[model samples]
Target: MNTQSLTKKWSKTICLAFLYSLSIFSNCYSKGNRIQSSDLKDSLISLLKKSGNDTLMIDSVYAHIRINRRRLGEEYKNTLLEYIDYTTKIQYSRGAMRMYDRLGLNERYDERYDSAVYYHLKSLELALELKDSFQMAYNYNNIGQAYRLQDINNLAIKNFHKALELQEANGNDKGASFTQNTLGAVYVVQKEYDQAMHYFRESQKIAVRRKDQRTQSYNLGAIGEVFLLRDQPDSAIVYFNTAKDIKQQMGDKKGLAVSKHLVGQAYFKKGNYVEAQKFLNEALVIHQKYNNERYIALCFDYLGKVKLKQNQFSEAGAYLLKAKEIASNIHSYENLISINNSLKEYYQEMDKWPMAMLAIQQNQQINDSLFSLKKTREMQALEIEYETEKQEQQIKLLSAENEIKEQRLKIGIAIITLLVLTIAFGIFIQKEKQKRFVLERDKVKQQLLRSQMNPHFLFNALGSIQSYMYQNDVKTAARYMGNFASLTRSILNNSAVEQVSLEEEISTLTNYLELEKMRLQSNFQYSIKVPEEMDIEFITVPPMLIQPFVENAIKHGIKNYTSGGKVELTFEETSDLIHVIIEDNGEGIDTTRGKMVSSHKSMATSIFKQRMKIIRDKFPNVPEPVIADLSDVNRKGTRIDLYLPILELTSTSNA
Candidate 1:
């Protein structure tokens, strides 16, 4: 299926889950057990307190919250926030993970897939730290669902497989079945019906063996969808009816509604307009009761088609118009396209050529928008994958270095032990060897720092210049080339030195930022401020130490904005340190981070951190850089304060 169609289907799938949760709540509360509205807040607070320091209690509380979420509505969010805060305060990692997962689910319902993924990843990290395989599998499934909603099928499949592996390993058959069903759904969207059926059947077998009615109902509906996709309407109806029966037995009103809709669709395909309309209308009532706009629109479209087939032209037009209005209000392009296509048919049958033409035009516009959205998501996914891989490679490199260091340390200890026994005989020789080893290590460290100015930047800058040249923008290309050349020269000149004058560092940063601004079509503004009392020429700092943060602020933060992007660099001298602060008025770090698929530890940032480690080792009195999210301070950006020892350059050549 195309992205727009898949998106519409995904929305309904999410709504189904929402409704299922509601049903769970209803089942729990039906026997005069419902919490009164006035006691709801106090009840939740009591649950939180009772959950203190107890994982099982926390789990029970989370279950209650999940089931009651719909009834709690907007209040559910505040309750979750309070629960998260309490868990965090008590250092309850498991509780915090559960709450984060719930929060992510809430975000997903709001169609904020990026934010949902972020919270899921946070929960995943905690799961990893706690070595909780069940939570890990659950989080992986959640992340897959988020990616699936975005139409990022490859990533969604990857995460689903990860979840499936862990679930099976942990002997969580029910969890495994759930993940299998999710994987099948993704394959269905990809039009791999055969593969989808295989997964659906596997899930169904597991669900039947486990006596998991909920899972069985889900798998049955999925199997029906596969038949529907293959144009086997009779086969689809059989499965849909079975699913509907199971849902009714389980008192799953939401699942029953979904199955009814699918069954109605199959009936329509079989040309049983009267039967299709009956089921579709029934599903429509449930959807309207739940305020599920996507399903409401879907039912309207289906009902219109049934009416059209029955030759009820006026009724068909009315239903189609209703669907169109809902689709427009919700910005559901797929539904709008379907409604318009139905409108076109209605107009053509009525001999209204102008109305049919207008419908076709509107349909084409929606298709174009969907195509553009697909391209944008593809590009973002590619960028995220590339960055994640790069960071993984850097991490592997660091791990290898650490292993080598450990081996070296062991060897040194052994050598020292041996030498101690022969100290009188080899003291002078040992001292000379130790001195040489220190010198070589320091030399290697300096070389590593020099190599840290990644070649990727130079290549990308050159590529941009080439792009501008090819566009025949001679003046703009020339200016970009000049800045690139100047930045390149400054980097090469400073790479050999331990430090550079503050003035030289700032100048290089200025050149680099200017080129980036031009490359980004002047989307951002920047400033460098040095205290009047401080001598920029005399003070020296580690070469390229501050550039990474500045680069991050621009690329990840400001790049999201079309205009009003601002970055400020300020230098202040304390008695023992030079404070260099880089701040940006852009989307805060959290928003920028949500766009990333994985938390890629940046190579530049890693190198800077290593450099800081070296400084802390060599000059014990110097403080390290303090990176802060300005949002924590009630501001609107990121701030990095680098505290450097006020080292003066010996000469201009050294700088």
Candidate 2:
């Protein structure tokens, strides 16, 4: 049967679950039990009245809601909100945390990532204040999952690792398994299949040991996704079917629907159109019953593709349009992109060139919007990171201040013991204070230099945006603006930290180059190359360290070049240092002149030299940066080699 027919026939699963719960309550009430109520809210109110101010009873209610939160969904949101207020009135921290966490999960189910993260963070704060490590870990996992859903993989992975560490430390194997599974899912989105498989297998091992059927089913489905991505439909189907059977037996209707969808995808890949359509329709029916527009849209899209493969153009068009309508209604750009691509194919097959063009245009616009959305999410992630780092710094500062106060108090007491001893202690304290003052001055100086560099970077980027805007090129201007936001996000994010992964540094450089490329109207081309064997994520480097040199290379070496200007960046690592080479095939620096051509170049060079001097003095063993003039070598380019210390990031540092 088709998806539409199946959807029409399927009854509401949530209603059924509610009815089942009601039946249990009815049965208990008929036996003259105290648990007599017309609905869950009534029973909750009765329980509250009986419990009075008992914290344990309130906690139990919170626990009950958590256990059945999936079944409850938004059905008990108002009840939970009311309970949260009551918990707050009674100062029940644990109950409030659990309630907020459940509300976060419900928001997550509805794809309200911002609300989900907000609630999860609220729960995390309570967990921290209460010193509840398990709750902290659970909330971290939830927050990570919310970020993961929005494709903010970096922040998601960071939160997942945080949760994993706490879970493993607390010996909460089930929580650890869940976190590991989520980590695998994020890796799956990132297309790191081998890494994904590793986590999945590890999670599966724990789930199996604990006899966690739900987690086992999740693992199976995740493993199937890896196989599907690898184009091993035959293998994928086996795993998907196994997961589906488990979910069915476990009465996880939502999970079963997801598995059926995966099964349909495997069948589609295996060229079994009939089987694919059947499974997709079945999944679509469940999705419709649950009112899951995202999955319903996905089911329709896949069904449309299946029909397209079978030469059923009319059926394909119908399914694809239905998918598009639902996707558009929900503003699911990613799904709309897929649906449009399929519709483009359908239009082409039917020889409707204009319709095909329209579909392509729609996809392009959707892709642009997706890019903007991605940048917005990245900005949100960066803001969260910055806030977290700021809080940590403030905590450290407070601790240091407290320690200093305690030291002074001890010194005062020690002074009463002996005058001579006091003199010696006074001298020692003076030296320590002087040392701290010097350290603080250096830190402030470094921060000043960084602050200077950021404004310079921002001004250059703003100039590029302004240039496009002047030309009445709205499309290019918008694209450039999006890239600018992305670059600004990276800068603001890295500005909070002293060091960042080489991968991040490279990404920032790429964003800068993209903006420059657009601004220069493709007058210059650039390439950044790193060795394939390099583990960029494991290697930490100074944040925004290379951008100034690249900026110099672009503005001085290539800006006025007539044609074929190119800038190349290459990375090489020795045992002790990372060698970053920036080479530009343009006019080399003219040393014969009395001074540099631009004040910006002079300041950039001076600031870079000072930063390098600071690094050298701090780490005496590190090599200094080198600049070579290609003009002297009879080449029309400048080459700079930056020898940075190879700092390895520990697992803890990633958090």
Candidate 3:
């Protein structure tokens, strides 16, 4: 049988068997008195074994877990994980696929999109191996959901369309309905409201026909949002009320809260502050109960607006302040913008011109940040497209080569010498191509290293200069700006070079440290020492290799110290290698502060390690870099020793 036919056959068989098994399991559970979770788990395991490890019996158990997943609390994820382990042990691909899909759903609920996508892709691979169209569509839909959360709209739409196509081909109305709803959401985010409503209506029709109340409710709310965006508050409220009624009937507190919030927004836009406040307060209570920070902030923002309209300035200020705090803490840039705008309005109403000006300035800064972020996403999208095109071209080249090989085979001995020549030329071309590829790859890696130099450093350095300028200390500001300019120039120049003279590297480090010290208001002192015997001009080291460690030392270690912070760098040359030792006199790497340092520190460390590995691989005589925490030896700081092979001019030419 064909794959599609086989999928259909198995799906039908599994559905029937699953239903029968579910009925038996439900009946047994219903007949019993209250049973502990341990007893229930043991009974399920016994039944699983008794059924000869049947996949259908496993599905029934998964179904029960999923149905009561919310009630299972924090243990629900663990239960699914255990089921996955059991299914894998039995070599049950279908059960494992389902369990993986469930785990992805759990991750998605937790807002962990990367983990969700990983699990969904795992499920997709297994589904493909099994040729199971149902599971394939399910996983595709889920992967799309994860991508959508990450705002990767193009990939999300592609996966959603794939799932929709599969669902339609398989006559799975339920799956198609869900995919339609998802596509509508993507369009809504893109601000294509008409297209969004079209898909939402399609989904609503199918969901209503299928008696899928949950999906129908979601569609109603989504359509209401489109109306709200169109400024038709009355129409929006009508749909919102319908969604709210459905959610209430289904006892979906979260959905009900969202609908209530939307209804409040509609009323607020219509200038009905009393009704808006009532609905918003109701939504706030539910959101708080659910611990939904984003929604809680939204509630506070709307409440603030309501109070402002009521002329309750004190209450308005308090609500707006709370919302701003939450939005800033969560790094919700869009929400922060909204809160700033509200603050601007609040201050304007109170005739606080300075406060209003500050609010406007902050809002402008946030807008710039949002614009930068959007451009970054667009650039990433372009990179993805470029990679896809590159792969397509590669495939085309391979296909042409295969065709040429076939033609050569047809000619036989008549073209044997020509074939040999062609093969030799091909090998030469391949070798040159690989050389160019490696050069380009290395160039890109170097550029990435330059780009990773923290942009925040530049911003703060400029801010320090600006502060000095504001204080009318032109001399101080000029000195700071000169240092900043020199450091940036040195970095840009070094980024293009494979290695730099030790003297030049030391000069760059001195300039960088001077600027940082000024930025930190002399909170830390730094010293660089070079051995008298070492030839600083002759010896060469990798550009920017040691700077990141010093930067980390200053930022994570010394900066955290209240006073008397110090960072020292010493360079020593051995017979075969140069050792650059960086030591910091500050509180050691505390486990409590590890999380804060892990992000940027880990990235820089990982990049440095990878670069060192590449160098060691190229020159096997080089030793690996070593890093040590002196706290392990009853000391109180971090010490990193970088082992770099010294490159002379002739050695560089040889390389």
Candidate 2 vs. true structure, TM-score: 0.48
Candidate 3 lDDT score at position 519: 80
What does candidate 3's lDDT look like per residue over 254-359, in tens digits? 9899999999999999999999999999999999999999989988998999999999999999999999999888988888888888888999999998999998
Put down candidate 1 lDDT per residue, 1-655, tens digits, no spaces. Answer: 8766754554454344334334534543455545453355556667468556866446545544653565566688788888888888998888888788878878887889888887877777676666666677777788788788888888888778877877676666656777888889889988999989998999988878866666788888899989987889999999999999988865567778999999999999888988999999999988888898998999999999988888999999999999999999999987888889999999999999999999999988888988998899888778755654574354332222343455567779999988776676576577576334221000001111334446777677767767765675555665565455434433432343576556656666766677777777778878888866455645667767777778888877676788789899998866436788899987566534332111345788777778788887755657656656688878888777777865533321100
Cα displacement (angstroms), candidate 1, residue 477, comes to 83
Candidate 1, superposed: residue stretches over 4 Å from native: 1-103, 285-292, 387-655
Candidate 3: misplaced stretches above 4 Å?
Answer: 1-96, 99-115, 289-291, 381-655
The worst-scoring run of ten residues by lDDT in candidate 1 lies at 439-448
Task: Write the candidate numbers in order of decreasing TM-score.
Answer: 1, 2, 3
> What's the distance in Å from true for residue 115, model 1?
3.4
Local accuracy of candidate 2 as per-residue lDDT tens digits, 37-88? 2355655555555557876446545544443343344457777787778888
lDDT of each model, Cα atoms only?
A: 0.72, 0.72, 0.72
